[model samples]
Structure formats: C-alpha cells, structure tokens
Target chain A: MNLLFAAEEAEEGGSGLVSPVIGVMLWTLIVFGITLIVLWKVAFPRIAEALDKRQRMIEESIDTAEKTKREADELLREYRERLSDARGQADDIVARARRTADAHEQESQAEARTKREEMMDQTRRDIEAETRRAIQQIRSEVADLTVLATEKVTRKSLDSSDQKRLVDEALAELDFAALANEERR
Target chain B: MSQSRKILLGAGGAYLLLVVLAFILFGSAGRQDFVPQEEFELPTWIELGPLDINKAVLYLLISGILTCVTMVYIAKRMEAKPNRIQTAVEVLYGVMRDNITRGNMNDKMAAKWFPFIGALFLFIWFNNLIGFIPLPTGHHHFTVLGLEIPTFGIYAATANVSVPLVLSLLVFFSYTFEGIRAKGVGGYLKSLIPAGVTGAMAGFIFVLELLSNIMRIVSLSVRLFANMLAGHLIILFMAGGLAILLGIAGIGVFLLPIGIALYLFEVGLVATLQAFIFATLSAIYIGGAVAESH
Candidate 1:
C-alpha cells in the first residue's frame, strides 16, 4: 500500500504539480464555498450583532448618566433659586417687623409722656383748690370770732360788709403757704 | 522541604513519568531504513474513471464539514452576556475581524468584506490545525487483517497542493474580480504597464507584472503547502532516526528532544503562521484590488 501511493505520486505529477489536481481543486472549491457561505450567513453576523449591541448599550448607559446629571443640575439650580427667594422674603419680613416694632415703641413712649404731664397738671390744680377752700373756711371762722367779741363789748351784731371786710383782712394776714415756704428756707 | 518545593518536585516527577511513557509509545517504533516512498504518494481514494477522490480531498471534505458544524454551533449559542466558551469564540472572531477586515480595508469596505475574510481565516486555521491530529491511517502502509486500508493515517489537508491551490485560487479569483470591478476591464489591463512607458520597456514591464500576477497564485499555494509538508516531514525524519540505534527501546533519544520540539513547533508556530499568512495575503490582494494606494 505504501509503495502503491508512491507510484501514484509519480504518475500524477504529469504537469509538474500533482498536489493541485483538477478534480481535488474543484472538490476543495465546492467544499470551501459551502463552508464559507455558512460562516457568512450564520457565525459572523451573530458575533457582529453582539459586539454592536454591546457598543450601543455602553453608549446608552453613558447617555443616561449624562442626562440624569443634567437633570440633577437643573433641579439643584431650581432649589437654589427657591432657597434664595425664601431668604429674600424672610429678610423682607424681618425688616418690616423691625420697622413696625420701632414705630410701636416710639408711639407708646410719646403716649406715656403725655399721660404723665396731664396727671401732674391735675394734681397741681387740686392742691390749689384745696388751699383756697381752707383759706375760705378760716376766713369765715375769723369773722365769727370777731363778731362775737364786738358783741360782748357792745351787745350788737356786725353788718354783712363788716364780716366781709374782716374775712378779707384775716386772709391777707394769714398766708400759710408763704409761711411754709419761709420755714423750708 | 518547603510545601511549594515538595509540590514542584511531585509535579516534575509526574511530568517525567508522562514523558517516559510518550517516548515508549511513539519514539520506540520508528523504522530506520524503511523509507516510506509511498508516504509521499497521493492516490485516489475512490477512482471513478477521471473523477478521483484522493486522501487530500477526503481530508478537505472532513475539514469543511467540521468547519461548518463548529461555525454553526458558535453562531447558534452566541450570548449577549457571553459565557466562557462564548468569550473564547468572540475573541477568535474578534482577532480575525480586527486584523483581516478592518486592518486591511476601510470601515465600509471592511464591513462589506468581513464575512468572506473571516470565513477564509477560520476555515484555513481549522484546516491547518486538524492536519496535525493523527488518525488511524496506515503507518508506512500496513494492513490490519489482510485488507489494506489505504490512507488509513492522519493527513494534513492544507499540506496538500490541491487544497492550498483551491484556497489560493479562490482568493485570486475574488481579488481579481474586485480589481476588475473597481478599475474596469480596460483600466485594469492598462495598469499592467507603468503610466508613461511607450514601447519595449512598456512591454517588458507589462510582461514582468503579468508574470508576477500569475506567480501570486503559485506562490500562495506553494508557501502554505511547503510549510505544512516540510514541518510534518521533519517530524517523521527525526522520529525515524530513533530506529537507527536502539531498536524499539530508544527513538532518537539523541534526537528525541529536538524531534518533539520540532513537532510542537510545527503544531504551534507553523500552523498558526501559515493560516495567518494565507488570510493576510488574501486581504492584501483584495486591498490591492479595490483601493488605490501607495
């Protein structure tokens, strides 16, 4: 069998290349074509598709992250704006209240000063009236004493003018408020 | 001893034992003077008058069917979330596509030609690899039970001229067709000579370019075939030297290390390199055809 193949090699080498026979070349072509077609149809496409899908998926993930980040930045900006607005409103309210409080304090202070001035004036008027009443009562009493003394001497009642004149005189002579001022000095 | 050292020693002993066993099986039985003159011969497996099915053809057929089956399986079981086998398959396909298609052509053209390029790469790669695997073919042409099983041994299909010839021819046809399509028939023919040459020099350049173009097919086939064939022959020659001295006891004990090393080199380097060369050359041809560049 070994020698048989050796003989075949020599015989087949007619055109200087036995290895590239017409029949086997055709056979190889046919077989190779079939296998290549199958590979083209099935294997390569699936692999490419998987690789393509992986690439797209990676891009999509990155895109989603970027979008989310943008949205977060937008939300943060909104919150910051709102926070500053609230701060402005709070500051405005505090300033308004402070002005209102200052106004209220000043108004109460003016009202208190007016009320004290009125009370002092009323007290002074009461003191003056009381002094006048005491002086009037003392004058009446002095006039009655003077009438009684004259009546004892002459056994006659005093006229009205006389009583009036006597009371006036006694009020002029007894100045208790002036005498109290002198005592204090 | 340290634990690591102990483990290393144990592993070394085990490896030594395996090597010894391999030498006994493959090294001892090499025939020294028994020149397998028939080993070079390639007769028709089934002769139907002129339509012969030789061992090379049979190996090609086997390679084709297996290539189809494997490719189909890879396509079918592909996952978006790849598992281990899927990852490995993806890596293989990635290498072919990246190096051959995108490396050779522009993106659009690469995409267009990916399937063809990948097919050639994978088919040739598998064919070259399968050649090394030993089958039950006859060793030095022996019979089992009074009946000779012709070609009853492993054969490297790619090592055969017809196989590489067919493959290279396919490439030649494709690239040539692409060239013609790109440049038109008139322009492509006109390109045979340099742009300004008129008479004898033009003719000379045309003849030279024409000869080189024809030689492309020859060189492509011969390169792959010779490499594969030479690698196998070297391995056999070394193993055959074992029977020169120590009978069945020692096979190229002197040559054992070198023989085994050469065999591994054949299996690893030559196989991969040839496949790459074939595919890359095809791409270059296609590139020359479709695109105009320096």
Candidate 2:
C-alpha cells in the first residue's frame, strides 16, 4: 500500500528539485521538435503566406484609391480650365458683335444726313427757276397793257421800236429782280 | 442600490459566515506536516527501456498537441475579414512577428527563425496556463460506488527544473550555432568582447563574456522554473497547506481569498508574461549572435 502511494513517502536526502532527469529532457526535445516540425511543414507557411497576401491587398487597395482621387482632381481642373476659356471666348464674341452694331448705326445716320442735304439743295434750285419765269411773264403782260392805254389816250398805233422801248421802261420802273428774289426766299 | 451591488453584498456576507463557521468547527485539531515536495515529485507511470513517462511528459505532449492543432485550425480558416478567433490569432501572430522576431533582427534572419520562436511561445504559454487548472493527477483518490478516482491537483511542467533546463539548453546551442555560422568560431568569440579595450582588460572581458554566455542557459531555465514553482507553492500553501500544518484548518478560509487572488494574477498575467519574456529573450540572443557588434 505504501509503495503504491508514492507521494506519501518522502525522499531522504534533497527534495530532488534541481535534479536533472534524462528521460524528461529527452521527451521535451522530442515533443518540442515534433511540434516545431509539424507547424513548420503544415501551419506556419500557410499563415505567413496569408498574412503577406492580406498586407499586399491592403496596400494595393490604398494605392488604387489614391490614384482614382488624383485622376478625379485632374479631370476637375481640366474642366474648370476649359470652362474659363469658353467664357472668355463668349465675352469676345459679344464685344465684337456690339462693336459691329455700333459701327452700322453710325454709318446709317451719316447716310440719312447726306440724303436730306441733297433734297434741300434741289428744292431751292426749283423754287428759284419758277420765280424767275413768273416775273418774266408779268413783265410781258404789263408791256401789253401799257401799249393799249397809250393807244386809247392818243388815238394812234406805235411801231416795233416804240413797243420795245416802252416795255424796257416799264420793266425798269417795276423792280422785277427784287420781286423775284423775295418770292424765292 | 443597483441589483449587481446587492448581489455582491449578499455574496460577501455569505462568504464571511462560511469562514466563521469553519473556524468554529476545525480550529483545535493537532498539527500535521503537509509537505509540498510530494506535490512536485514526478511518479513514473510507465517504464520504457530508458525513459520514465511521468506527469511532466504528459503535459508536454498535451501542450504540443494543443499548439499544433489550434494553429493549424486557425490557419486553415484564415480570411481577409477575420472572425473573433482569427482576429485574436492575428494579434498573436503580429506580436510574434513584429515585436519578437522582426524587432530583434533583420528581415532575412527574422524570416528564417520565426517558426521556431512562435512554436516556443505557444508551447510555453499553453503549459503555463494549463498549470493553473486542476486536473485528476493527484496520488490521492476518492471512492464512489466501489470505484476509485484520482483527486484533482495543480501542477506545471515548467515548474520542474529539468523541462526548462532542456529548453534553455536548446536555445543556447541554437544561438551558438548561429553565431558560429554567421561569423567563424574565432571571429564570433572575438566579437563577444566590447570594443576599445586592450591588454589584460581585453582578455579579462573576453573571459567574462564567455562565462556570461554560458550562464545564459542557467539564468533562462532557473528564471522560468523558479517563477512557476514559487507561484504554485504560494497558491498551494495559502489554499490549505499552511492551515493543515498549523492544525488550524479554519485559517485556510481566510487564506483562500488571497490564494484566489494570486491564482488569478498568475493565470492572467504571469503565464503570458513568462512566455513573452522567454520568446523575446530567445530572439534577442539569436539576433545578437549574428550582429556585427555584441
């Protein structure tokens, strides 16, 4: 019974606390070596590979995202530049059209003024001609009436030279040139 | 008060009453010697020509199997988006890779030695953690329905000096081999001495460095063995050993709480910490061996 219960029997000398046991050491070596081998062959390689893959995946994802953002920013900048150029072009076109319209208006006003001046000159010339003709006719008619009155008073006919002289005297006495200038004004 | 607070108060009062009752019943018994030696002694279960299979060997086997299986399982199921267990394993993997291996050595060396260091950490960690758990390994037995069953007891393979000594010896040889491989034997030895010393001082320093290099095995082994042995001894005594030796069983009631706290401290911090220290020291030694300067 005492032999079966080994823990109940105390050792005589030391407690054997620091004593080296060859079997235990050998077993430790064997067990640890086996574990290390199994893990090295089966488990560790897979895990290391997976971890490396995951790290690469994360890095690639980050790079792709950064690249996309950079492209988007570049596109936005280009669009803004194009829009600015278009706005400048539109402003230039509007200015050119306004300038052309202004030039056309000035040209039309000058042409209208020239046409009015020509019409006024032509009307003055016509009035001068008509007044002159009326004055000449009046002179002729006066000469005829003077000849009839002279005949009635003296009871005698006059010759061609006498008629001409009487008409020139009547025309001079009447101031027919001044009358024609007043009618033209 | 809150419901949790009320429950806590009730539990505390109950525990106090139980202690008082135990003190009244068993305070006057005659003293008895409950030696701790018996607990640490490894009784052989089987004899094979040159080997004696014992509790320590069993524990080592269990630790090896557990380390292998758990890592393999997690490895097989690993994904880009990890679940809880995979996340935890990844954290441990990072610690081993970045903090232990890569932190100590360059990429080429780290890659070469990561598997060994990782296995060493998991093995030691599992051994330490399982030591705190009570298992049916005690020499004493209980009878029920005419059947005998061994009682539960706490023990650690690392607590036995032989196990850690063997592991330290392995580490010592590994680092020495690496040093010799990286630099020839003469160069490696010469590198051990610090720079800018001459004459007798240089010789003396070289001898001292050689002795210190040899002492690494002892220091590494004893540090782990002593810490584990001390923690288990304290816990055992505080639980009942002291009370039984003093003939005052009731004293254990008071000591049990302290024992519980120590138990938690060992399980929660010391176990993991010892593993980390052992693995980190191994990495440092290996890395130092190949370095241009000591």
Candidate 3:
C-alpha cells in the first residue's frame, strides 16, 4: 500500500502541476482589468482632489498670514506718526506758554514803573505849592509886627515914606532870621 | 507611450520569440514520453552528502543572474530622455512608487520600502517569463557520497510551495516588525483587536485576531504558490496534450495545426498573467499589511 502511494505521488505531482496555467491567466486578466478601471475612475481621482485641496488650503493660510503681518506693520507706522505728532504738539504748547508769561511780566513791569513815576511827580508838585504858601504866611506876619513897632516909637502920626522905610527894614530882618532857622532845622 | 505599455510590448515580443524557438526545437525532435527526462536520469553536475546541495539552487542563481544582468544592461543603455526601454523602466518605477509603496505606506515609510518592492516585482516577472524559455528540461545529476542522485528541474523558484512560503514569511515578519516599530508592541497587539468591543466579545475578537495573524503567512504563501503552480501546470498540460496527440500513429499530423495554435496562445497568456498575478498579490499584501487603523 505504501509503495503504491509513493508511485502514485511521483507520477501525479508534475502532471497535475502543469494544467491550470491557462485558467489562472484568464482570471488574472479579468481581475486586473477590473481593478485598474475602478482605481483609475473612482479612487485615484478622489485622492488627487483631496491632495490638491490640501495644497490650496496651505497656500491660502500662508497668504493670510502675510497679509496680517502687512496690516500690523501699517498700523504700527500709523501709531508712530501719531505719537510723533503728539510729542510735537506738547512741545508747541510749552513754548507758547513761556512766551505768554514773558509778555505778562513785561506788561506788569511797565505799568508799575509808570505808576511810580506819576506818584513822584504829584509829591513834587505838592511840596512846591506848600513851600510857596509857607513863604507868603511868613511875610504877612512880619509886616504886622513891623507896623506895631513903628507906631510905638514915633508917639505921633508919621508920613507915608517914614512908615514904609521902617516896615521894609523890619521885614528884611525877619527874612534873615527865618532863613537861618530853616537851615538849622 | 507609457513605459508599462512599452515593457508589455517588449516582453510580449521576447515571449513570442521564446515560444517560436521552443516549438522549433521540441516539435522537430518528435513526440516523447509525458514525464520530463530528468525524472528518469539525472544531469551530472549535482552532488549529495551529509549536507545535500539543492539542484534547483543553481538554476535559480543562474536565473537571478540573467535577470539582473539583462535588466541592468537595459537600464544603463536607456536614453537620457524617454525612449521605449527607458519609458518602460520609468513606468515600472512609477507604478511601484505611486501605487504600491505610496498607496500602502506613508511617504516616509514608502521611501524606505520602494526599492525592495521594485526588486521583488522585477525578479518575479523575469523568473515567470524565463519558465517559457527552452532551457535544459530534466533533473540534475550530482554525486552523493560518490553516488549520483537525480532531482527535478529548478523548480521555478516562485512555483515551489517552500520558496513562496519563505517569501511570504519574510513579508509577514517585515510588516509585523513595521507595525511593532510604528506602534509599540503593546499598541501593535492592541491594534489587532477591534474597537468598541467589551468583555467576552473582546476576548473572542483577540482569539480571532491571533488566528488571522497566523493565517496571514499561509494566505500569502498559498496565493503566490497557487498562482504560479497553476499557470505552470496549464502550460505543461497543453504541451503534454500535443505530445500525446503527436505520439499517436496516423491522425497526429492533422492535429498539429490546432496544437500549435493552442500552444502559442496558452504560452503567451500564461507568461503575462503569472507575472501580473505575482505583482498584484504583492501589492495587495503590502497594502493590507500597512493600512492605517479605521
């Protein structure tokens, strides 16, 4: 039985192996054709589209980022300009205030000087008028004294020339005494 | 035109020449026995001992060398700009690049694996086409302890169950390694279990996953082995049928026309399809192995 099995195995092995090549070939052709068609038509197109969409999305994102950066730069430039303008305005205000203070100081100083001068002039005029009035009062008092003295010395009524001379000499002596007293005080 | 189309044409032409040569050589010699000659007597080159040397290994090595040299020569002579041969190679590269590697893996992963897949496809393709050529048909004769023993013709490396099994095992291990490396070992194991399952269901799923994981090796091996073996078998039967028909006394001459036509058609289709099947399965396996979790 074992010998028979061995003989059968030897005879059958190579022959059985050689007969199915044609059928396998036909089957392969059909399957491969079907696979290729399906892949080319449906699957491959979808995969390619997905890849293209991904590429577009990435490009768009990069573009948006670049645009944002540009906008930020523009805003920064505007802010810098505004800051510089503010600094310029602040300097101008300080300068204007300084000039106005100088003008006010000058005006105040001029008004004060003018008021001092007017007060001095009024004091000088009052002193001059008072001096003139004092001098007149002294003269009248001296005249009255002189007239009393003359009348006592002569015991009678005198002529106009004698009265005049006595009055003049007395007045002269009173003027000299007044001048010396004024000098001592 | 496309490189693939050009390669199809070239390969097709080469195949035609090979078929014509086989018919002229074998048909003129007259009908012989159904069993290949090597089965009865061994070729003198092989030897056996405590460590037996495989007769098929020498043939595979020769086939590999021929394939590599031919492909490299074609690649080198390719035009700087696109020509027929260059276009064919380019299309082959493109198919591997765009479809197999990139389709299966992320770009980073695909870059590393693309070369291996390319080499694999070319090797299998050349081997399958070479089978139709009129090489020495029979077993090898080698000395074993000063004794000679016969072995079968270089079992078209892809046709043997063992060879395809090993290829599949290599793929199986490599992908499993990739999964483990990509995700940690724990995570890799976890990935095998479907999400949203609970308790007993999860346990059941894990068992199923384990079984399937083991079955992956079997499936990969069987798919390749069956395809190549089946194609080879069909070609043999067709040829054998002609041989048997011609061996008959009188009516054999009339059947020659039908036999010749069928032989031409069968050989052509078988050669092309075997290569295609090998490449297609490799693509599918790699695709399945590396697909991202849903």
Candidate 4:
C-alpha cells in the first residue's frame, strides 16, 4: 500500500496522505507483470495473426477469381475462332464439288458427240463400197451372157484370151473410189 | 443469452426478494461509513504477512480475473467471423492500437507499447466502472446462535493510490528503460539539457527538465487516483446525503433523478475517458523515449 492506502495511519488522525507501504507496490507489480506477460503471449499475438490471415485469404481469393475469369475469356475466344474456321472449310468444299461436277458434264457431252459423228462416217463409207461392188458384178455378168448368145447363134467358139480382155474393160468403167467421193461431196 | 443466464437471472431475482425481506425486517440500514470526509482519505487495509490488502486490492484482483476469463472464453470460442464479445474485444483493441497508440506514437513504437498500455487501460477502466457499483452485502450483521456472519464485497481498485502507483511505476520504468536503451546513459542525461545553450541557462533548464521527468510518476498516478477517487467520493456523498435526508425529513427523493443521471455519466463517460487518457499518455511517453528525435 502506498501512503494513501496506509489505512492504519490515515484512519488514525491523518487528514491527507498515509504512510507509503512498499509491500503493496511490490505485490501489484508482480501481479501486473504476470498480466503483461499473459497479454504479450496470448492476446496481442492472437489478434494480430487472425487479422493478417483474414486479409491474406481475401487477397488470394480475389486473385484466383481474376485468373479464372481471364482463362475463361481466352477459351471462349479460341472456340469462336475454331467455329469460324470450320464454317469456311465447309463453304470451300461445296464450291470445289460444284466445279468438279460441271467439268465432268462438259467433258461427257463432247465425248458423246464425237462418238456419234464417227458412227455416221463409217455407215456412209460402207454404203459407197457396197454400191460400187454391185455395179462391177453386173458389168461382168452382162459381158459373159452376150458371149454365150453369139456362140449359140453362129455355132462358133470365141477366143479365150479375147474374152478376159473384154471382162477387164467392163470392170474398169465402174470406179468405186470416184463414186464414193462424189456421194460424200 | 443462454439458458444458464436465464436461470441465473431468476436466481438473482429471488435473491433480491430475500434481500428486500431482510431489509424490511432489519428496519433500515446505517449510512455512517458511506460518507467521504478528507480530500485524500479513503479506506484502510487488513495486514497479512508483510502485505496490506484492502477492498481495492480485492476488486483489482476480481477485475483481473474478469479480464482473463473473458479473453480465454473468447479465445476458445473464437470463430472465422467474430461473435459479440470477440467483436467488442477487437473494437476496443483497434481503438487502442489505431487511435491511441498510432495517434500519439509513430508506427515503430506503437506496436511495442500497445499491449502494455492497452492492458493498463482495460484493467483500470473496468475497475473504475465496477467501483461505481456498490455490491449487495445485506448491510446487516446476522447473528445465528451467537455467531456474527459478515459478507465480502468489492469496490473501485483504481481509486486506491497504491494500485495507480504500481501502474505508474511500470510506465515510469518502461519509458526510462527504453530511453536509456535508445540513447546511452550519458546521452540521455545530456538530453535533459537543451541544445544551443550553456552555463547557467543550461543548468536551469536541466534542473527543470529533470524535475518534470521525475514528476511523470506522480502526475500519472495522482491523475488516475484523484479522478477515480473523486468520482467515488462524490457518489458516496450523494448516497450518504440521500440516506440521511430521507431518514430525517423525507426530502431526499426529489434529488434522485439528477443524482442518478450524474452518477451514470460519471461511471460510463468518466471511467472510459480516464482509461483512454492513461493508455494514450503511456504510449506517448514510450514514443518519446524510443524516438531518434523528440
């Protein structure tokens, strides 16, 4: 007890101030010192740590959220780009298929027309050759019939070498190549 | 709050009824010891061993226990988010740390002295508040079979000069130690004399500064002790006067309204304000001590 707490003396006749008791001060110091130590060890440290941890957790969550948002945006952009690329490819394929079909149709038309013209030319040439051959055969048959009639009427034989010459001259008069050219013109 | 608290309140109500019955039976109590007289005079202590413990000491111990229990309970029940008591503790801690410690001192010294100053603030502040409340001790000597039974009660511990002296001495030693540690002993002594002065002027300034430095303990202790003691005395005087007048002329009832209001203001405002002043001043002292330049 300090002078004020010296109740014995102050109560005795003292109006103000009591004898300072050293023991009270010492005990108070001991008790207060224990309190201070406890505060240092427990109260202050715990509070400071809790506050710091909360702050850090908040900041980390904010950072993670931002990162996730950025990554999502990037993915969206990539998907849109791929979608456009696929559309363009589909258009190009359609155009290429149309061009191939048109070229094929034109080529087949030209080939069919050429085949018809070749068939007509072959039919005309065959007709010309048949007509010339029929003409030559008729001429030779007429020469032989006349010779037979002369022989029967006069009762005389014609010379063999002269008869062959006469048949050759008749075949010469019916030219097949000339007649076919004339018909073609 | 809790089921237990409801039960406790119920018990308290029953106890109050018992006290009322006892008061009625005893037929009014004595108010002689409740009055204040001398300026510095308070209560005395009962000597045990070499130490003299008083009513104030017991209350001081109770204040400490209250602080400990509250903090420990909060610590055990602490959550990711603060509950009521935890929030109260944090708010009080924040005020001391940011407002008082950081306000008077720079960042460097604020962190160091915050705990010490804060502890003193809470301890003194609560004790001062509890001091205003007079416990129900029945105020009667009950004799059962020729044995007198007494009750135990607590009051304002900070009003006692010894309590405040112990607190002041802690501040005194802490700052002085920090000052000496910061600047060497010789430099600290030299610092008492101002710069750019010599001879008589320097000596005069040195003596004044030294005296002022020594007076820090007295100012700190006396300021708290006086303020708390003054409030207690004033309330005691009011209570004693009311009791005396009521017993004599029954005129004391009229004073109840003003008396109750003033009492509330003193207990609530004065108690907290004094606590703040004590902590802030303590921080400022340590700040000055450890500062490279004052």
Q: Tell me the tens digit of each residue's lDDT in model 2 across B50-162.
A: 57888888888888888889889889988988888888898999999899999998899998999889888888898898899898887678988998988778888888888
Worst 10 residues of 2 chain B by lDDT: B30-39
Candidate 3 residue-wise lDDT, A72-179, digit = tens? 999999999999999999999999999999999999999999999999899877876666677767677766666766677767656778767777777766554465
Error of 2 at B34 (Å): 3.3
What's the true lDDT of residue A99 in model 2? 100
| Tens digits of per-residue lDDT for model 4, A1-185 | 23244345556764223334455566667667766777667777777777677679889999999999999999999999999999999999999999999999999999999989888888877887776776566566767876786577768777887666755675567565575566557
Question: What is candidate 3's CA lDDT for residue B112?
Answer: 65
> How well does each candidate superpose onto the true structure, as a TM-score?
0.72, 0.83, 0.48, 0.63
The sequence of per-residue lDDT tens digits that candidate 2 reaches over residues A26-126 is 98899889988988888888888888899999999999999999999999999999999999999999999999999999999999999998898888888
Best by lDDT: 2
2 or 4, which is superior by lDDT? 2
The second chain of candidate 4 has a TM-score of 0.77
lDDT of 4 by residue, B160-266 (tens): 67778878888988988988988999777777676677888988888898898889988988888788876765565454354452342122333444567768888
Question: Candidate 1, TM-score vs. the true structure?
Answer: 0.72
* Best candidate (score: DockQ): 1
Query: Candidate 1: misplaced stretches above 4 Å?
Result: A1-19, A42-80, A83-87, A94-106, A113-117, A120-185, B1-31, B34-41, B106-112, B140-154, B192-206, B234-270
Select the stronger candidate by DockQ from 1 and 3.
1
User: What is the total number of backbone clashes in candidate 3?
Assistant: 16
Q: Give the poorly placed runs of model 3, Cα more than 4 Å off.
A: A1-8, A11-185, B1-45, B48-55, B139-155, B241-272, B283-290
Question: Alpha-carbon error at B157 in model 3, in Å?
Answer: 2.4
TM-score of chain B of 3: 0.69
